[model samples]
Target: MMASVNEYYQQMEKTGIPKRFTHVLPPNEIEYKNWLVGQNGLPPVEEWRDRMYAETVKLLKTMQDGCKDQWDDDYWTAVIESKGVESPTNGHSLFSRCS
Candidate 1:
């Protein structure tokens, strides 16, 4: 687990060893307007749909692979779907369904 790794790294640091993670992607946000229909909210946009999906999937699978032992399938799915993707339609969020 990451926490255990971090702990080990911390102990090593006391003796002057560096600790590192192989894969760490910074975070970004995706707007949900496109997923929603033209109601009271903003109109949908086409550009974001494919890109958002691709990016979301890539980030998710990468994280899942990296943290395979740290998280169960359901937990990893929850982390990605909740934080990364957006669904403006259906009056719900992609992360919600992922959970």
Candidate 2:
């Protein structure tokens, strides 16, 4: 018989982190910006903003892959807000607590 989703997640969790966990971007995007700064160039602000936005989305996808439990948005938002990150103004704010 097929295992229930919860059972499957529990088993996977016991086996250490999933392979997708490695797909996350480096925790410090600032390092990338720093490298850019060292390169002697500064183009349109909106372009950098768009790159940040896209990177943020990719990071969120990585988080989703690592989140074995199928938690709804409300649960996650409440968890985030409860942890004093009411707005999660930055990417690290919301995901730094992940196991």
| Model 2: worst 10 consecutive residues (lDDT sum) | 89-98
Query: Model 2, range 1-99, lDDT digits (tens) per residue?
Result: 346655655655786757465334354445565667668776433343445465556656877556543334454456556656554444333333447
Model 2: residues with Cα > 4 Å off, grouped in runs: 1-45, 65-99
Tell me the deviation in Å of residue 21 in model 1: 31
Clashing pairs in 1: 35-89, 81-95
The residue pairs found clashing in candidate 2 are none
Each model's lDDT comes to 0.49, 0.52
Instruction: Give candidate 2's error at residue 6 in angstroms.
Output: 42
N/CA/C clash count, model 2: 0
lDDT of 1 by residue, 1-99 (tens): 989877767866786644553122222223434434555576655454545565556667778434333223354345445756543434433353331
Candidate 2 lDDT score at position 29: 48
Displacement of the residue 38 alpha carbon in candidate 1, Å: 24
